[model samples]
Target: EPEVTQTPSHQVTQMGQEVILRCVPISNHLYFYWYRQILGQKVEFLVSFYNNEISEKSEIFDDQFSVERPDGSNFTLKIRSTKLEDSAMYFCASTGTGSPEAFFGQGTRLTVV
Candidate 1:
């Protein structure tokens, strides 16, 4: 079965540095999402992309955060400036058209010092 894949399963960065988290969602899925879970906290939705535009976004997705589907097979999240609070396990997920259920990737753990 196809699953979402993320690169650099773990990343360490200095505060104020930039980080780009990459993901490849299931091939046939039409909707993609980015979510983050701060250590010991509930999962939080960051943004959703469809048809090459942001379909929705949460307040956490601020000026420092951006999402892009640079090509058919790749989705990415970029943090322009990392902060201590930005350290978290960021997840990439997707769903087929009309499906409420989402398949998630293992997540990329970002550690900022």
Candidate 2:
């Protein structure tokens, strides 16, 4: 079965630095989303993109963050300036609709120093 894939399973960056986390969502999926989880917190939705534009975004998606579908398969999240609070596991997920069973990539662990 096809699956979502993420690169650099773990990343460490200094505060105020920029980082681009990459993901390749499932080929036939329609909706794409990014969610993050702090060490002991609940998974928080960051943004959801579809039809090449943002469909829904949470308050946590601030000016420092942006997402892009650079190609047919690749989706990327760029943090203009990282902060220590940004340290978390960023999961790339996709589903055909807004259902509870979205498939998530293993995730990219971001550790801001």
Steric clashes per prediction: 0, 0
Looking at model 1, residue 93 earns an lDDT score of: 99
Model 1 local distance difference test score: 0.97
Candidate 1 C-alpha lDDT tens digits along 26-98: 9999899999999999999999999999999999999999999999999999999999999999999999987
RMSD of each: 0.7, 1.5
How far residue 88's Cα lies from its native spot in candidate 1, in Å, is: 0.3
Q: Please write out the lDDT profile of model 2 over residues 43-62, one tens digit for every residue.
A: 99999999998999999999
Candidate 2 positional error at 77, Å:
0.7
Q: Which ranges of candidate 2 are over 4 A from the true structure?
A: 97-100
Q: After superposing candidate 1 on the true structure, give the runs of residues whose Cα lies further than 4 Å from its correct spot.
A: none
lDDT of each: 0.97, 0.94
Highest TM-score: which candidate?
A: 1
